[model samples]
Target: MKKNLNFLMGAVLLMATVLFASCNAEDDFLVSPVDSTGAVTRSVTTDPYVIDFANVPAAYTASDKYGANLYTGGAGQITEGYKVQLGNSGTYVQFPVNYLEQEWGEEPRPWQYDYWNGGLAVSDYTDITDGTYLNQCSVYNGGIAGVDNDKFVVAYGYSDFYNDPLSTYDKCAKIYLTDATGYTVVEEGTPVEGTVKTGTFNSVYVCNTTYSQIVMRDGNSFTTGGKSLEEQEGWFKVEFIGFASSDTSVAPTGKVTYYLANFDKSKEEESGLHGEIRTGWNQVDLTDLGTGVHMVVVNFVGSDKSDYGLNTPAYCALDNLSISL
Candidate 1:
């Protein structure tokens, strides 16, 4: 009887150990591993690709050579003006003059003409009340038509700009796209949270001080047949442009910052892309993206560390936003 009782106790302990081991295995499957190399790798069983707004068509005025109003507004107010044009290349679309006013502050902060000591210097506008302006601009061409339908991937690149600070925000631009109905905000640029990418420079009015910073959010997205495309097969691309002023009274400094974020419900956290002080633009490619409705968000940040505090004014331009396939 004694021997039988001992045997039964041993059996019960073994069973408990086995059960505990099984539970641990299950937990391991749910949590991913963090490698020592500072790189994270995960095993995704579902579709990995998604669409992004890179280059959407721009809204042009009746005077534009590329058919007037090729892109019409869908949900928001549409303005008619000469689409912001890139230099001599004619490769990019243009941003509107009121972009900053529409995106950030309510009032228009006009440039202030002032004098310091014995020389003449201008007051750089910083408050959102000052207004929206674009002093610089550029364009990017993401090779889309060449890739196969299966190769649905897009990317956007960002670079730095050098010009007058006071006129940086004079007229910024962004690209948009429309389906059979009209244009929708496919991709655009916005202000970022930090300093501009370029080096430090003197403020227009505060000549004794030098500061550098330009933060704006710029991005693009993709859509199909008038609907937000979030499937694994869709793709998109975009590029950023920086504009500056020519007058010494309006010296602009800073490089473009880049960010890419996805709006899918499943992958919200890992859906963001970013780059800073980049010599060139950064590219984000979403291939084999999931299906359904989707949206892509781009962010641009500027830095202002002048005597005016963190509120020093800045500006940028967007253009050549497009979508295909």
Candidate 2:
């Protein structure tokens, strides 16, 4: 059964230095600090490939050619002005980048300048106050690993897109595996680039965005008939569904569901279970999805429903995503 959900500018010679420094920093982050013998400690089999947005190359985040900026609802946002180049096809990660040209420069496209559509986006916004504004795209605890961590990815899950075959909303963070360089989609029997032999779903850290946390804890003016989760006896969660290589039709190896908020009156009354509005960062293990999983589709579900789908804010912040091959 299918579960329904809704849901850089930079430099040069100093640029080369920045890119080299960024890669080295990412390596350093993945492995421990070097020792007396200049040997870094890391278990190739155990240490998964982690994607920390803070270490994204300067060229991708700052320069004019392949830059991406967070949607700040101001002059800083870049809807269609920027482009992203996937370095290689072996194994690459991508967040949705809906170009304005395709949709008449719409304001709510996946990569729009104002409101976020259902998709994945890179963000470092840290405002935790004013949950009323849909544009406040920050984790409640600020970061998954720590409060001061530089960057994380925000995901908006729309069930209508995932459930509707004709829907065009891009609603998931994708890791593509290609047979060779320059390819964007996964190919069966094609080797993934790097040392990874087979793609494995490890884990990811998830937390409620400020907009979601507040709306779940307290009623918001919009949606759910202006009722909180407590009042509506509702729940909110995201599902990570893993698919086989080159195949994405409903069938998946497995699915992992992580709840962002749950307010069941029965459970609270009978088992002494207090309502849970997720705070800080919680790790959702995906090992159950198993190895050889090339793609994972994430979507959100909530008890508050209208004809349009989930009424609760469908936003979640993710960080420290670990994948192994």
Candidate 3:
């Protein structure tokens, strides 16, 4: 979610300079935006706290420091101001920032949570004043350490800047999760629709399994764990077909529009690039769904696929994700 939209950065600062009114706490406590002045606007450039994957150090060299959080990036080096708590314990917090080094810019992690209520970009999630409702489940994949978090199999997702845990924490913590089966992981051996090996960026150039003489030249060599995928790069995308809920039975009554792109979308459309995520950041707009979301079952689609399976890693860094109260 980490976007480099400097063109609109000034707007956030300019708006913050002015003071606004507060909202009614006793009213719709978990459903609407509570700007004291009654008018609150949020964008990638303007949010109380943006969870851009800045935690992964810019230096992803062949050093042990790069091993930060091999799995879901714990809150080790995330941008200051937010605290991520996994499961119900409220301990061992980690900022989700993976060490992604690529030819272009680098800050991409795939979605990996089990369930989601929705994403938020409120004024102050810390106090929970103007109706801020959130899903209070274990926000990670592979289930929580000791607890039984596998019950929520349908898989829901959320991303934001606040860190207001459901418990009695002062700051507005935010939690995120994705269904490993439907949203991100296709497993090591899954039967994909078409032939995975298309003459695309994924099959020809980036996949770790796909050998190439241009490996080092393309800056795609990760020697730490000797893991082939340590070098996965570029922005990957997934279209939540039908309903945002991962329930294959329910039909998606809405659409998924993007708010970030360097070029005109039309230019990319009508070709393979259409709907496919590019090298830069893209704001995935899910406002149509509102907050009445439980389990999200998407007719998932990806950009990377090998003749064997999904090779284009399904991860990307997140930032400036806004949600209404």
Candidate 4:
């Protein structure tokens, strides 16, 4: 009887050891890094290049007008040396600017009135009130985490320009990578070839503009027939279309869609998404786009539509764009 009892205890110990090993293996797998869409597997090697806008020029911070820099005429001092540098690596992420017409007229035909209506602009506007309709450049959350950073880029996809038959341009903002040549010249002692100019996109932090968030949360005189987005069961989203370096003329390599606000009950039930308006910065993963992603076109769309197209404000704030280069 003593021998039998000892054998039973040894069997139990073996089972416990096997169970512990299995659990440990699963834990490691879950902790392993996976792509945002679960379509690609990647390991975090070098630190990602983060575009936090910490080095913007002092002129951009002037308080004479609004807190945002319009990047007027498509290029200026800000665009001249725009780049992101980390450790020994540096690269350029150029925001597509609408070309300004130079007719040599007085005031050059008020911007966005008779000329460009969409593009990228740098902003630090932070008024989060519902009635502050004039402050279209402000982000509702003020910044990523509302403290860590105050400057970010606002993308405006002009549905009017896109839908206009005579217009030959789409106002959707796009980001393209380039070597740090025409922009920031490498300083002395900095190896030029070490710069990785292009890589697969990892993620980007995004938030709603004060204009968009307010209009969506509370109906305005202009849209939804004075019905709030939630009352109208509306939805809004931003799309990132990734293009490979070799063949951008072809179809996009991949696309990632992130919803800024969703009150559609059908979609919520189908996709298991809780319908809510986004007021804080949310991370949108793009790892599924794979490597050599040279360009990404940002587009905004929504359920609210009129004859001119998307009735919702075509604005969104972007910060902390991560790329594995």
Each prediction's total of clashing residue pairs, residues at least 3 apart in sequence or on different chains, is 85, 18, 45, 0
TM-score of 1: 0.23
Q: Which ranges in model 1 have alpha carbons more than 4 Å from their true place?
A: 1-134, 138-178, 183-276, 287-290, 302-325
Candidate 2 structure quality by residue, lDDT tens digits, 1-325: 1222211123335678888898554332331211312232243333355666775543333222112343444435533221122122234444443321123446543323322434455666666766755444566784332233766667765656334445322444344432223222133223212222246768888877777888888877776778888888777778887777534555687888777777886545432336877778778899988778866677777788776566787778787677664
What C-alpha lDDT do the candidate models reach, one value each?
0.23, 0.56, 0.24, 0.61
TM-score of each: 0.23, 0.66, 0.29, 0.67
- Per-residue error (Å), model 1, residue 213: 8.0
**Which residue runs does candidate 3 get wrong by more than 4 Å?**
1-236, 240-249, 253-267, 270-279, 295-304
**Per-residue lDDT over 19-49 for candidate 4, one digit per residue giving the tens place of the 0 to 100 score:** 9897544221121122342324233334465
* Rank order (by TM-score, best first): 4, 2, 3, 1
lDDT of 4 at 157: 67
Question: Over all chains combined, what TM-score does candidate 3 have?
Answer: 0.29
Assess candidate 3 and give its lDDT: 0.24
Which candidate wins on lDDT?
4
State which candidate has the highest TM-score: 4
lDDT of 3 by residue, 1-325 (tens): 2355664686676665542211121111112112322234222111222222223223211112122222234333222112221121112112222111222334452333211212211111011111111211111222221112111111112121222223211111222222111122234222111111100000000110111112111322231222222133222233332233333345544434332111224435432353322332234555454343322222212222334333322222233333321
| Comparison by lDDT, 1 against 4, better one | 4
Which candidate do you rate higher for lDDT, 1 or 3?
Answer: 3
